[model samples]
Target: MPSALGEYFQDDDGSLPEIELRFAQPALLVAALEYLFGLPGAYDASRDTACVWNLIHDREEPYRSPQDARRVASGELAAFHRLLRAAQVDGCVLPDLGVFVSGEELILDYRMGPQWGESEIVALLRLLARLRKRGAQVAVPWWGESGERAFADAIAGIDAGRSAAN
Candidate 1:
């Protein structure tokens, strides 16, 4: 059996365990998600995460429309779930402090930075809302200064809305 980390890069079965999607810029996150799930021949389970990372990092243009973005996000989420099922993994292990939904949790690890803009924040919140509707909890590992505070604010906003609803 291949290691979980190794399975991502060398399984050769063309199926991946989990994808550690990374985004250096906010605008790319949606596109990355879409490519993960929509673009044909974009993700190779047997390949390393770097391959997928490179593909997104190397893209030259924005998505054609909001519908296209949504399609990609849906596809990526589906692929993520499939990967988890195939590997019997609980959830994805993210590489950066960004919004990612896994299993029953919407996780935001803010140790990376607080450089995200309003659009990214709104998009992430929308994603988290969808996850919550599907019975997932939202969590942030680091919520202090640096990038943590911003993350905390985001979580607080979500929590407050949830609280108000209850």
Candidate 2:
């Protein structure tokens, strides 16, 4: 179960919060890239790193460009396990490889951040919005029930006037 977004940058103990997003299917990772790329921010997919597994040969090949990753993710390799490092054109507070793909789950762990600011939060929410729009189950295990409710409320209130409301 996930909780609400923490109000403070760090816990009372001075540790940063654990933030991660899980996608139930591997294809969702590709969907996430499309969603992120369409955002106002410019993401440098060229710097992205991808490790794609070949289902037929039972071997994995690593790629340093988004084109190759996208090709494999789009069913070129027929693989279920893929890892992608979605590089941001700006900012260093997030993980290097922002997304991970497993057999049936895609994980984005944000714990590598030195800190979580407004930009990071907005990036996360935007990604979540797309996942919801695509009818996939997005789980933020660190955010408890209240966090989930807050997210639902945010999505429900995504009219032109309150698109980013929490």
Please tell me which predicted candidate would have the highest TM-score against the true structure.
2
Runs off by more than 4 Å, candidate 1: 1-115, 144-166
Clashes of each: 2, 6
lDDT of 2 by residue, 95-141 (tens): 33344443343455444233455555544555556566664566655
lDDT of 2: 0.47
Clashing pairs in 1: 34-72, 37-75
Model 1 residue 45 CA deviation in Å: 9.9
* Model 1, total clashes: 2
